[model samples]
Target chain A: MQTTDISAAQQAMADESVKRLAMICWSNDLDKVWPTLILATTGAASGLEVDVFFTFWGLRVLQKNNKRFTGKNWMQKGESFVDRGGTDHLKLGKIHFAGMGTWMIRKLAKQYKVASPTELLEMALECGVRLHPCQMTMDLYGLSPEDFIDGLQPTLGAASFIDMAAKADITLFI
Target chain B: MAYPQDAAVQPPALRIDALGKKCPLPIIMLAQRIGEVPIGNVIEVLADDPATKTDVPAWCGLKSHEFVGAGELAPAPGWAFRIRRSY
Candidate 1:
């Protein structure tokens, strides 16, 4: 009986479905975006169904224009000025010398032949990784679906994301 | 352990030199080029990225390819991964 149970368990393991990787991206800093894209692309490349949920500051990356602040308040305007631009314009977390550090990182990445965040995103999309924006955050910021890059899945709520995460083989918060 | 001499005689059908390339690039290059070799034939990937140590095997597992083994490339700073196309 024990042997039969062991073999049944092995059969179940063998019959398991394809692996899934779900990630919650809550930060949009240059440093964070690099890892997020790298992992997403790599995960997809490695045969996992990769889904990245962009929320809060992380949604800034999916915006059509990185420099524009949609908010009406002065603080929002100030944040837009400081965080101007999309993936290419993101600032480093530390030693950000008036955008010089971001420039230097880009230059070094080019020199080393590393894929930039933009390129990684493109590759991830090509690899069939799903990109989802958080609807709650979008509504909070008054952002519509048209404001995001093309091919994004419909904006999802946290509960929907949780459902996806519950079934994923791996879940990450970035 | 000693293997049959015939096992050592077969050379890789394709070799990818990914030295100096960073993570994802090496893997991307391998993914693109693995198709160039015939199925069941072996392809050797030379990569310097530390991540490739795990990444290559993970890719093989995901793609249903065989991860034969990895060995150091003598006189150079990198690894040579041997993968057999399973399908």
Candidate 2:
């Protein structure tokens, strides 16, 4: 009886199922970008469905001039009420410096054969990684749709992203 | 050494041991190995961490790879997952 049960369990595990994940990314630190991509790509590679909602500085990863922007924005003077230090304040817990991280990603991409940010964005799309920018965040920052890359998906609100997250088997913040 | 005339063709293989590792490691290790496998091949991963149950499948979904399922190992130390590279 135990043997049979073990076999049954094994068989049950071997069955294929689609896992859903909704990732909420709010960091702009460039070093954190690859990990996010790596996680998303890995999930897709493993056959799970993924939705990525990027907000605030996180959009920089998809921006064309992301690498050009350095640490000191000089715009933090009066923005203490909102995120205090701008992108720097909202970076990932593991990575605190956006400038150094952005530089590292560009440097590493060049060192290896990995695609550029633009190419990576295309690759992400090709892999079926759904991307949604945060509407409220864009508006709060006074950013227009033209600020983002062409073909980028329209912005969504936190509620919309939350709705997706509610159904997801996994939700990540990076 | 002796050579067999009827040898079977086998795909490349990789083993990611993420036993006792944390949330992203299991997924990270699998990602590193997935890169080694050619498209249409399989990569095996052994992880004892509970987070892998969710992380591995989620990672697969993001990359379009086929998640082959994972479960507890009886009389053993960890769970094992099989991922087939589709791209």
Candidate 3:
């Protein structure tokens, strides 16, 4: 009887838990970032507890000075030059016409009344989506907490993120 | 088609025109303005974006609002979605 009662209590607790979505943002490409923000905002709007862990190049999305690169290595600096600018400077994955593709897409987005990446990011924040920066990645890139936009939670490691993701109903690596 | 409620008999308390707005904007506007009307009153949203068809209903379900139904808006090239504020 006690075992049955304990099982029932566990079931009840599970039923009352909030649904969660865990997303790992591993890319900073414009095409990739747009979908990440879209899904994050949509998930939050759908009443899911959403957490986004930004790592590697994904941390560029949160940079305050998007055009400037703080990397010490020449290769890292070259990458920063190629991918300069924050969310606004992201280029398309295919047929990129020396920044023209980005311009054309932005124009079409405006014409179609689609929200831009920046706007979607704002919406995601407003919707209460939790944003986390990978501490190890930040150290690799020499990024300080002050470099990121406001409202982000403290930088965390993969272990902590894994723990959170284990409890989530949905997990995606993007 | 039969609507969930007599939405035709009782006019919407507030109307939001989101004809040209795309995904997230129309739904965002609905979230912001649904509170303008009193409880139990309906709000009518006119939109052309295809996402609205699913987004509005999904939003209503998430917020616990009553999604009355959607119908074509004749004379205009758009759809009208009615949502009754439950809380």
Candidate 4:
């Protein structure tokens, strides 16, 4: 009789087997941030267990104190989606010329029927996309836990991220 | 060359050339092609660019395609990715 090891290996190779994905997105550029969200959400929707750890400036996206949308790094001249009623609360101090860019994006989305970042954020949460704010980066940036948007997971450290990656079938940095 | 007249009856093998394309395009193309192929068929993507090494497998992880590994091809100057459509 054949050993069951072969059967176990075969089962391991089966298509329906679950795959965990670890995605690290460290860029704070608003444009870059969305792709990570879209990709991570898409991954979760497609059945891959997904974890996204935001570090450095990337943590700004989840800051409750910084609820207003910001533009991409290079362009620096547009409104983020937050100004278009994407989120319920808007941080007052950060509001500036970038607000117009957010309006433009909303107008474009209305014209093109594209999903707004706010809509995407809702979808991401619904789809079980685990969002991790980095503890080290948060501390380095002088952001307290209260600064993060409500309902997001607490910040994680490098070792925990590595362990998550080790269990993941695939890991990505974007 | 144009697609064969009976292409619908005989599913066309997908060839995604994602060399030099950045970010989501590579992943997007891969996702699109996976849907086009029939289950159990093979799709070959030629991506010489380095990003696909990470992007392609990541896409596979999401879309349920089998990432059968990538390696240097017989002909130089690019890499080949083999994916088996499972969904």
The lDDT per prediction is 0.82, 0.63, 0.84, 0.64
Pick by TM-score: 3 or 4, better one: 3
Docking class of predicted structure 1: medium
Chain A of candidate 1 compared with the true chain A, TM-score: 0.83
Error of 1 at B28 (Å): 2.6
Q: Pick the candidate with the highest DockQ.
A: 1
What residue runs in model 2 are displaced by over 4 Å at the alpha carbon? A1-16, A66-109, A112-119, B1-87
lDDT of 1: 0.82
lDDT of 1 at B61: 88
lDDT of 4 by residue, A1-174 (tens): 466988877887864477788988776554566677777766766677889898865666666534443443423213334322123232222222455654655566556544545555666677688989898876555556665655677679999999999989889887
Displacement of residue B36 (Cα, Å) in model 2 is 18
Candidate 1 vs candidate 3: which has greater DockQ? 1
Each prediction's DockQ? 0.65, 0.15, 0.58, 0.10
Residue A101's lDDT in candidate 4: 57
lDDT of 4 by residue, B13-83 (tens): 78787765444445545765577878877777776656677877777775667776665555556667777
Off by over 4 Å in 3: A1-17, A65-67, A72-78, B1-5
Q: Poorest 10 consecutive residues of model 1 chain B by lDDT?
A: B1-10
* Cα lDDT tens digits for candidate 3, B15-78: 9999999887888778778889999999999998888999899888877899999988777777
Comparing candidate 1 with candidate 4, which one achieves the higher lDDT?
A: 1
**Chain B TM-score list for all models:** 0.89, 0.79, 0.92, 0.70
Model 1, A29-120: lDDT tens digits are 88988999998988877778899999988987887754376545676557666656467666787877887888998999999989988888
| lDDT by residue for model 1 (B1-87), tens | 121243246678999999999999888778878889999888988998998999899899888998888888777888888888888
Docking class of 3: medium
lDDT comparison, 1 vs 3, better candidate: 3
**Residue B51 alpha-carbon offset, candidate 1, angstroms:** 3.1
